[model samples]
Target: MLSSHCLNDDPWNKFPFTGFVAMISAVLTLMVDSITTSVFSRSGKEEPHADVASAYTPDQEMGRSHHGDHGLNLSDDKELGSTLQLLRYRVIAIVLELGIVVHSIVIGVSVGATNNTCTIKGLIAALCFHQMFEGMGLGGCILQAKYEWVKKAVMAFFFAVTTPFGVVLGMALSKTYKENSPDSLITVGLLNASSGGLLIYMSLVDLLAADFMGQKMQQSIKLQLKSYAAVLLGSGGMAVLAKWT
Candidate 1:
């Protein structure tokens, strides 16, 4: 994709391609996270458990409600906060999945549209390893979300199909689509840039921040260091793949 775009005589010179698409992606992710958080927050607060409510007498319930309005017990509050945090994490995982799907599709289409066998071989190798690691990360997030089996299957199916679907679309359009064309450059460049930004934001802010700052990591310095080292190694490996693809 970069090679194709470069053939168009530096599209970046005329357009602030990177910054524009990145800003759009950042805004999109922020909006999604904000809306999801607000909706979850309101839903979490408004629902009351009927079983728990039934356990209390009217007078005791009233007193307890009053106390809850003012303050909650430390342990209770901590438990409630943990539940809410998990809920938020599930939402973030969904959003992250969406960004990754978009990226996967774009890359798949680009790879499928190419005619060079040499390039195809290299891309196949790079993408195989790329998807393997990427899948592990995404699978971890989905597992953490604790989705039902059916929902998990559905998400997995969608993730699995996106690239193939893109490939199909690219093959269908291969006769007419010119990757180096001005139109293709603009469209593909923007899509790639936006997806890049979205993935970066989701990785750092949603995935990394939540785990690294969570209680388990915070309590263990050695674990934190090991995790950071793992992150760097994984990131560097992906960066190396970028050179080939």
Candidate 2:
């Protein structure tokens, strides 16, 4: 982003120092989040009620299929693993949404600040497909999270409103919010850069890795090949959209 109409525009346009810092910040932020999520998820083991615990004994433990200290039994272990996996997906959804929010805001603000009718029209067309595909991906994650209806609604509501809110904000400041201005360029560029980093990391690590490295995918060569084809097709479509954007 810093390569376009930015401080690095002169001579050979390239990503600037600011972009580097923003990318670094994104990495650090994700690292902290990863540690926090791992610690929290592990510590949040389901505990038996006090009464049940009081009556439980070594004999009771022997009766149950022990899966280490965090309770036993095959069904409960499966359920707990599923719950934890869903929780991880929920975190991914939130993080992915946050990145999308920042990116959507940048797109909306740029659209709002620019007076170029053709640019605005092209953006509007491209963004419709972009948001549609993005929503599909995020919706899949949210569905996997298996949140209650209220939480699902809240997440959907936030994602839906963010871009429009950015457009409104940009319009309110349009008089002074020059898209190419030093302040606007620096701010928007850094945000875009950081959000890009976050999105890339989450997509590769949390989303793709989860699916591609799973037992089902690993066990089926045909499925893996088909999945790769789908990923490439989607990626190619996004690349085309980026060109217009």
Candidate 3:
């Protein structure tokens, strides 16, 4: 119920805003990394199922040669590369969407739980900015995924409602919900931690590594360094926002 292991409170009871829990979180994250890596390695040998809804777009179709092509020529390096990029985009997009949706839900719940109108306005503002950037990134990925209209509409709908859904949930529970209760503490804290981990991994591996370590970014040291600086700047901006928000 608590993370306190301190001398007086035996910090194990209320550990949050503490280093011990942070270490445990890191350990948990490490465990997640290892487990996922092992599973991915084992599955790597197996063929992946193809999604017919987003199999290939007209542009991909046009990449084919005039010769009687019995099937897709993945033999063409450029075409193969493009296919890989599209797959990468789709995967990252889904992951990012899930992460942001969870995050929005949490933020919305907090806002909904609060009765102060002034605080609500600030929270709503933050949520808007947060979702705006997330939407831009997710939109680009979905575009690359080339999903059918129905699927795209579904994603858009979920993206639009995630925060509102959470707010409604919070309001519904407000009658009996106790934010200071142990259950609330653990539930919300763990949820935030999980979303944070997912976002971190997706940004680092699915995005940065996939791009920076690719032939494109690897070709020019100057471009790579510039990208690094840009990322650092972005990190600082988020850090400042965290300080206040």
Tens-place lDDT digits, model 2, residues 1-245? 45665555663265365557667856875785598568646654553221123233578556554547554476566655655565577678878887888888887788778888988898898889988988998999888766667778998998898889888887888999887776777788778777777777778778899899999999999999999999999999889978977
Better of 1 and 3 by TM-score: 1
Please report, in order, the local distance difference test score of every candidate based on alpha carbons.
0.77, 0.75, 0.68
State the weakest 10-residue window (summed lDDT) of model 1: 48-57
Q: On a 0 to 100 scale, what is the lDDT of residue 100 in model 3?
A: 80
What are the per-residue Cα lDDT tens digits for candidate 3 across 1-245? 23522223544454454344445554565565556545543443242323432566567556553535554454454444554555555656666787788878987787777777877887777777777877887787788777788878988888999899999988888777776666776677667776776767666766678779999899999999999999899788777766656
Over 4 Å off in model 1, which ranges? 1-11, 14-16, 48-79
For model 2, name the residue pairs that clash. none
Instruction: State which candidate, 2 or 3, has the greater TM-score.
Output: 2
- Using all chains and alpha carbons, the TM-scores for the candidates as numbered come to 0.81, 0.81, 0.73
